[model samples]
Target: MKNVLLVLFLSISMIIIYVFIPQQQSIVFQPNDSNANMAYIPTKEETQFKIKYTHSIHLTDVVESYKITPSKKIHQYELMYEDFSIGMPSNAEEGETFEVLNGSYYIKNMKRIFPFFHLRIGQVRANHTVIFKNVEYPLSHSIPPGTSVKVEIRTLNFIDLWKGVNILESL
Candidate 1:
């Protein structure tokens, strides 16, 4: 009975040390001089292109769905289900920023490792619908030329939750 109890106790102790102790002692990303983790920010030079398109307007529907709210410091627009806050914060607008790599269309010419930048904008925080430090420009105007308008753009990401699974959904 004594020998059996000693063996059982040793087995349980080994399992507990193997699973919990090492995980708690491991150090994750080492911090840089700026005190931010190097893993989070883009360390390489990234190329981004600015593209704009004008959506022509008809008199009937041009100004039908527009609501603009101007504040003392900045402007905000409320259209349909979204309320867009325009302009970046004063400090950020002066140019301190960070970004991430996103591929709009996978480029075939370059090596598979490097994806061409179709469009590059500021990185969005987790659980956010809009990109940071970006102006929300509304394409809902029929003005002759240079009429200031507010537009709201939303980016969507579809994640394949079952990548390593054996079966896929039947459609």
Candidate 2:
């Protein structure tokens, strides 16, 4: 009787902990308006991801590399683009370095940190794609074109993860 009771109690406690406690952190993309849906990609600290998009004006590729900090903040550490015009940044900020590497212009050591930011998916020409863990997730796959999204990091438990859409569904 004692052995059976102890086993039951331990099983219940584990289930409760798994359901209520946050086990992992993920990069969550929340819709800015009513036009889109929410999605998430499981991630961990020190993981690197890239948002690659086509420049609306220059028609070139622009890659923004980011790394998640230990505190779960988004750290944008590098920017790579082909040209400088219109909305493109002409030079690196005070502490960053601008250099040309392998025919592409790179702004290394950007050190831009953001708790959250707004991303506007391109309607026509811009194909905004997120590469996480070497998997490509195009926002337009699950979200409507031209939809604006709020990007943020969130800690989630199994229940929350089950409720949210996994952007990797398309993969």
Candidate 3:
């Protein structure tokens, strides 16, 4: 009888612990560093061709959405043609200081130049509709002509929940 009673008590205690204890919640951001983790900012170079048309989309639509409060401060960064290439390099210089719209096209910067600049439209957390070039796309869609598109990022925090953590670290 004593053993049975002890087991019951322990089971109840464990249940209580599980119910009341809160999971650790963390805030993550993208482009973690302002300078693209580079040692110094590179000189701004002129582009050969004019930017014909630009369509912007928010990150929340492309990537898994997270809660963002209005009170959270937004940080801005700009990516120009010279800073990014086809494939992302290990040591790319992230530029500093630019005006970025919160709900717009999402683009990433890399050290080397590539043929196409990757772009994503729509985010899970997007509150309103995003109309680009007179057409409406789904909640999330990949933008084509990656070469012509420029990317700007606006976020409350730079740490991203999904892409921030290293896959190996979880293991």
For candidate 2, lDDT tens digit of each residue in 15-119?
999998998788888888864557788875437899999998889999999988777889999999998878888888999999998989999998899998889
List candidate 1 segments past 4 Å from native. 23-171
Residue 129, candidate 3: Cα error in Å is 8.8
Show model 3 residue runs off by greater than 4 Å.
Answer: 24-96, 99-171
Candidates in descending lDDT order: 2, 3, 1
Please list the C-alpha lDDT of all candidates, in the order they appear: 0.21, 0.86, 0.28
State residue 135's C-alpha deviation in candidate 3, in Å. 20
Candidate with better TM-score, 2 vs 3: 2
Q: Name every residue pair that clashes in candidate 1.
A: 137-150, 137-151, 138-150, 138-151
What are the per-residue Cα lDDT tens digits for candidate 1 across 1-171? 999999999999987666444221110112222232111111122111112332122111111121111211111211111111232121212222322223111111111111111212112211111211232222111111222212222111111111111111110
Question: Which segments of model 2 are wrong by more than 4 Å?
Answer: 1-13
Better of 1 and 3 by TM-score: 3
Tens-digit lDDT string for candidate 3 (1-171): 999999999999987666555332222112322322101111123111112112233122322111222332212222322122333222325542322245333333322333222223223333222222233333122221111222322221122322233211221
Q: After superposition, how far is residue 168 of candidate 1 from its true place, in Å?
A: 23
lDDT of 1 at 143: 17
